[model samples]
Target: MTAAVFGHDGPWTEEEYLALGETQQRVELFDGSLHVTPAPTPRHQRISRKLGNVLEAAAEAVRLELLEAVNVRLRPGRVPIPDLVITEQVDLDELIIEADAVRLVCEIISPSNAATDKVLKMHYYAAAGIEWYLLVEQETLTMHLYQRQGAHYVERSVTKAGAALELTEPVRATIRPEELLG
Candidate 1:
């Protein structure tokens, strides 16, 4: 599609946003606005792959699925593609995973999108009633875990490099922040 089809005039509709289809960048919708981000660095992908491996086993043990970079529809006109999600099994053929099915949403914070991942997405995820939120800091490999309490998220745990992050609510797992680098 041409740039004209995207229309730079008004806030984007869900239909318009989805019609963008797949691009080389990461595109998300929030309150009818489209936020486009460039593809992550190779280091980001490496950390994501390693951490997903660690979480996948824990998720599978409880019959949940671990997905990476999936479209999660928090609501109409609000869809943020989280870096990782551990969720109840849904139809893989579907393009979007509803918010309620998600048990945990994880985002790896790079210097470029730190605020969006740590603050903006945190608010949206908690508002959507997602039970768990995990944040990983790229440079230091620090991990923060939060659980929803009422309309917001409460900080549950923080694990730095060389430490173990033990989680029990969404699934049972122990992760070391440093291990995610390799």
Candidate 2:
């Protein structure tokens, strides 16, 4: 499938923006503009859900929270719904209503969103000061992990079916591609 194209324009408020969501293409309000991309296919969802479950189960003991496709506010009104998020257990009061940022952010890559997930979104996560960022490539069925190094991120490990990706504090379990992409 081809990528979804959107017209470039000034940023809009959260209330005024998501209400104008387009039916022609999938779009995200990034920094205020409509960052568009084609819809993810079934295979993409399978991989994403698979990994989310693994991460969630592994984090149960530590009380680390697993957020799935939840909108997060970075600045006053800036928001983006990451595919997966790992964070500390905090009050639900400000969630979904405030600009709450998490410590770790992760995304599953689809063919139509390869660039957005790998590049644009990566930069966005860093700019938000997230500690760890993860990229899961469904095409290759592997996980690429990164950790912030003084405001920048260093690619820590790339794990395949035979191996596992190590997680951060609170969630000490490792994730395997077989458990994620199978």
Candidate 3:
């Protein structure tokens, strides 16, 4: 919490990271280091909001829950704030949400951070036992849905701007990728 360099070497803990308080920038923990990401762009936020809305109705019908841009604590040194997290309902009084409760995690890829969203976070989510992960590309309005298979994730579907994606894994829903843009 006290002023210190973020992304420091070796042995960082979640308690120390959480004490930093509310910050304008988004921060995530991986491999005992902190990774700071700037707040999402307006377009990014819009896409995230739209996706959450569509997923919300589907989740409601099934009695599941959806949360946007929430912190998911996988372990002591591995908390990642995903763009949109879909999970079973939990007590609002809890301070942290565990990874096991998360059924799906979605990331709307920013141009500058595509690798992290597409590659790194995919690995993290699968390793954490999340059954579904969605990657939305901003420029093309393409959404890639992955389903966890064994210890890895396999691409289940890819929907472009005009197409509707039908998902049956983490939840059952039909989503048009372009709808996320406007």
How do the residues 36-150 of candidate 2 rate in per-residue lDDT, one tens digit apiece? 5666777877887887887788766767788777667666556777888877776665445232347678898887778887887777677677878888888787888888777
Q: Which stretches of candidate 2 lie over 4 Å from their true place?
A: 1-10, 18-26, 91-101, 168-170
**How many clashes in each candidate?**
0, 1, 0
lDDT per residue, candidate 3, 1-182, as tens digits? 32654445566678767777667888787877888888999999999899999898888888888987777987767988999888899776665789989999999999988999988999988988899989999889899999999778999889997789998756789999878877
Residue 150 shift from truth in candidate 2, angstroms = 2.6
Candidate 1 per-residue lDDT, tens place, 23-139, comes to 778888899888888899999999999999989999999999999888999999899999999999999988899999999999999899999998899999999999999999999
Query: How many clashing pairs in candidate 2?
Result: 1
Worst 10 residues of 3 by lDDT: 1-10
- Scored by lDDT, the top model is 1
Alpha-carbon TM-score of each model against the true structure = 0.96, 0.80, 0.93
